[model samples]
Target: MDIQVTKIGMVSCSGEELPEGTISRIACRKVLTDLKPNETVTICLPLFIAGGEEERKFAKKYPTITVDGCEKLCAAKSTEMFSGKPSKSLVVPDILKKHNLSAPKKLRHFGDEDQAAIQAVADEIAKSVKEVLEND
Candidate 1:
């Protein structure tokens, strides 16, 4: 016998001005394509905040993880306001601080150091995905 579970929703900041925002997006893609392909779906923040879309509707019914690029936490805040609080929340700055990583300074291009930070964020998100799947 096999039991199937609903996929986790991922909402990440889309801000283009910050490196953290870029990191958030890349990490989300890693989770979807590499880490949790069979167990996750990407939720578009622009669609969710813009009013009408299937992503928001799907998020309302599933366990969602919100990834924020900055302390402002637009992704988490929007998810909470439109649906409910996310099942898990990740902030790039906080993660970097916890891991003793310096924040990325460039937005257009990333160096090797930034790649390391991105990898750390992706790893943590993948771990959270595992936790949510197991608990669900």
Candidate 2:
């Protein structure tokens, strides 16, 4: 059976500036496309805290993948607290640490090193998602 997957990201303070090359988005798309046709994927951003009830309900019925930037792990924590399901959490800080990268101060000011780090994170997440979906 194919399981639905949800990709969630926490909000960054920088207005109008998204952290470039965050694998959260790319990994999300990869999982969605690779999953069976019956499966569905949704991207959730924490900027709007309101419509979470509906999201929580959906998550309960699906396999949610929560990607958190930095050490906050907001997406993963919120998924577990509100959705009541154990989410597959990808902590960006942990990935960055593997590559000896320092966390960026602002989302908008992502340098080449930051981009590379994000790409590595995204690639790993995509691999994990694919493995889970295929094995299910």
Q: Give me candidate 2's TM-score against the actual structure.
A: 0.62
lDDT of 1: 0.87
lDDT of each: 0.87, 0.52
Per-residue C-alpha lDDT of model 2 across residues 92-115, encoded as one tens digit per residue: 667667877665555555566556
Q: Write the per-residue lDDT of candidate 1 for residues 1-136, one digit (tens) a residue.
A: 1213568888999989899999999999998899888888888899889985577677777888999999899999999999888999999999989898876889848888788898889888988988887897
Candidate 1, residue 43: lDDT: 85
Count clashing residue pairs per candidate: 0, 0
Candidate topping lDDT: 1
In candidate 1, position 5 carries an lDDT of 56
Off by over 4 Å in 2: 1-40, 102-106, 109-113
